[model samples]
Target: MLKITDLHVQLEEEDKKILKGVNLTVETGKVHAIMGPNGSGKSTLSYVLSGREGYEVTQGSAELDGEEILEMDPEERAAAGLFLAFQYPVEIPGVGNMTFLRTAVNAQRKARGQEEMSATDFLKEVRAKAKSLKIDADMLKRPVNVGFSGGEKKRNEILQMAMLEPRMCILDETDSGLDVDAMKLVADGVNALRDEGRSFLVITHYQRLLDHIKPDVVHIMADGRIIKTGGPELALEVENNGYADLLEGTA
Candidate 1:
């Protein structure tokens, strides 16, 4: 569903490059796990794919189902069936979670030439999805991610993904700060969304989360490049031996 080829990226104000010729393809009905140490440009790939500003694409192309997404704005990307569950979800103090989600969902539907959902319909659908994700109704009525715990925030992101139903979803460090229970909740939400026409790129450092989601392909990224690709066993190997051996050989 997504293809990234020879993707090179650098911060505009800095001379240093982050991603150097990184390439990968995620097909529909599969999940890809990108495991890398800190500063490996894993998050950069997510940001660049989502069209965040300040990251210059020196060379490369990211295509979603044969359409180039590098030229699209962030909202356009979302409307084109791309979703990014951030590593650290931002808090919008004044925006209630329900209000924010309804706005986003309606906006995407409106862009697609569909009529906006009525408040009652949106509430019913969102409540069902949120309940499936184990998000409390009270949380939905509060400000987005404001005063929420780390696990709560991650669960909220998953709730958004479930509500959005994007064709390709990128989960960046969704397990970063969650407790075991929260991790399971987040993983369950992702698993529930997995299907034949959708794909996921899960960026994480630990193998624990993969045990629940079970990625179809595992990739090891370093120095802004994907140096190794393997099956689920690769994640176990990395967990057991760390990135040392992979880095030594690649270096």
Candidate 2:
């Protein structure tokens, strides 16, 4: 569902390359995990794929279902079924979570030339999705991520993913700040969304998240490139040893 071909990215201002020939494919129904140390361009790949600014794709292409996506605007990318679960979900003090979700859902539908969901239908759907993510109605009434705990924020991201139902979900360190229980909850929400048509590219520095998510493939990234690719065992190796052995082995 997602494909990258020799993708090279660099900061527009400083001209420092971040992703060097990042070629990856996340097929339909598969979960792919990317584990790497800081500054290795793991997050960079996600940002670039999501059409974030400040980074320029100097070479190669990113395609979703054979459609080129790099030149599209961020919202257009969203309309095209691309979703990025931020490493840090920003707070919107003025927007209620429910309202924000409704707006997003309707906006995407409108962009795709579909009718807006009625209030009753939207409410029922949102509530059901929230329940699956362990998000209560009270939390839905609160401002988006304004006062949520770390776990709450992460779960909220999952809620967005569930509601949007993007074809390819790019999760950037979704487990960064969560406790063990919180991580499991977030993982459960993600796992619950797994299906024959959906794919996941989970980027993390640790394997604990993968322990619950159980990716079909695990990739080791370093020096702005994917240095090695393996199955779930790769994540275990990273957890047992650190990036040290992996880095040395690659060297």
Candidate 3:
């Protein structure tokens, strides 16, 4: 569902390049995990694909379902079925979570030339989805991510994903700062959304998350490029051996 070819990105204000020729293809219904050490540009790839600012794509293309997305705005990318779960989900102090969710959903629908979901239908659907994610009614009434615990924040992100139902999801360190139980809860939410029409690009530093959300393909990235590609065992290999061994000849 998503294809990236020869992607080259650099800081807009400086000459430091983050991603150099990143080529990846995520088929519909597949889960692809990207593992690398610090500063490997995994998160940068996610931001670039989602059309975040301050990073310029000097070369290459990121296409979602055969259409180029690099030229589109961030909101346009969302309407095109691209979602990015931030590493640190930001807090919106005044906006209730429900209000934010409903507005976002309706906006995307409108952008896609579909009718907005009615208030009754939206409330029912959101409540059901929130229940599945273990999000309480009180949490929904609160401002987005404000006063939420680490796990609660992560679960809220999954709730957004569930409501949006994006075709391609990019998770940038969703496991960070999450406890064991929290990680599993978030993973369950993610697994619940997996289907024939959806795909996931999970960028994480540890293999423990993969134990819960088993990826079909695992990639080791270093020096702004994907250095190795393997199956699930590759993650375990990195866990046991560390990137030291993997970095051998990568320089």
Candidate 4:
């Protein structure tokens, strides 16, 4: 479960505020979707929660399973079961995909005081997860996201999520740049991992992705604040009317 209360964030080098009082809770075993227009701070909230630099938390706090994560380093947060699947997955050239993944998996295990998985176990696990996400062997042999298509990158992100098995997953627009088939494939991978012990916070601009991923709750965010909360129908409303009607007095 993730709990965010009155969270206010501002860019470190400027006077502009990005998240002004973002209070939301993602209960365990549930999927929560946040829909908003451009510059609404949806992505900013994801970065801030994952401990990305350049943004200062001016007020409030974010907690994962009742533990404060604001003070933890990025890797420390990962060790504590927090994962962010970026909208644009970065490319790390000259590093084999398997090598990068094994290092990350073992590093987190070391940080959590768990034994490192042997090469055989990791190989078995990664191959299974990659297959589920439709990641072929050739793709895994290449550098991370080096020549991957948009859908491949997103699927790779899901594969990371599956391999890590984080309790709270923040998917920052996993549907971005994905066509219908790719989106459905990605959603299937996400849905396969849903369980009573894991939760998801999906940030998106449209409802097509929600159609595939059926969120339990939907929130309308505008001007750095979550202004409205409702059920899955809320996403339908946004698709029907857009954010203009919802933004009438939210400014």
Q: Each prediction's TM-score against the native?
A: 0.99, 0.98, 0.99, 0.99
lDDT of each: 0.95, 0.94, 0.96, 0.95
Would you give me the overall lDDT of model 2?
0.94
What is candidate 4's lDDT per residue for 205-246, written digit by digit as tens?
999999999999999999999999999999999999988998
- Please give the RMSD to the true structure for each candidate, in Å: 0.7, 0.8, 0.6, 0.8
Candidate with more favorable, higher TM-score: 2 or 3? 3
Q: For residues 2-73, write the lDDT of model 2, one tens digit per residue.
A: 999999999999979888898898899999999999999999899999988999889999999999999999
Q: After superposition, how far is residue 19 of candidate 3 from its true place, in Å?
A: 0.6
Query: Which runs of model 4 end up more than 4 angstroms from their true locations?
Result: 249-251
For residue 4, model 2's alpha carbon misses the true position, in angstroms, by 0.5
Residue pairs with colliding backbones in model 3 are none
* Clash count in backbone of candidate 1: 0
Q: How far is candidate 2 from the true structure (C-alpha RMSD, Å)?
A: 0.8
Model 2 Cα shift for residue 167 (angstroms):
0.8
List residue ranges in candidate 1 displaced over 4 A. none
Q: What would the TM-score be for candidate 4 when compared with the true structure?
A: 0.99
Which digits, one per residue and each the tens of the lDDT, describe model 3 over residues 129-150? 9999999999999999999999
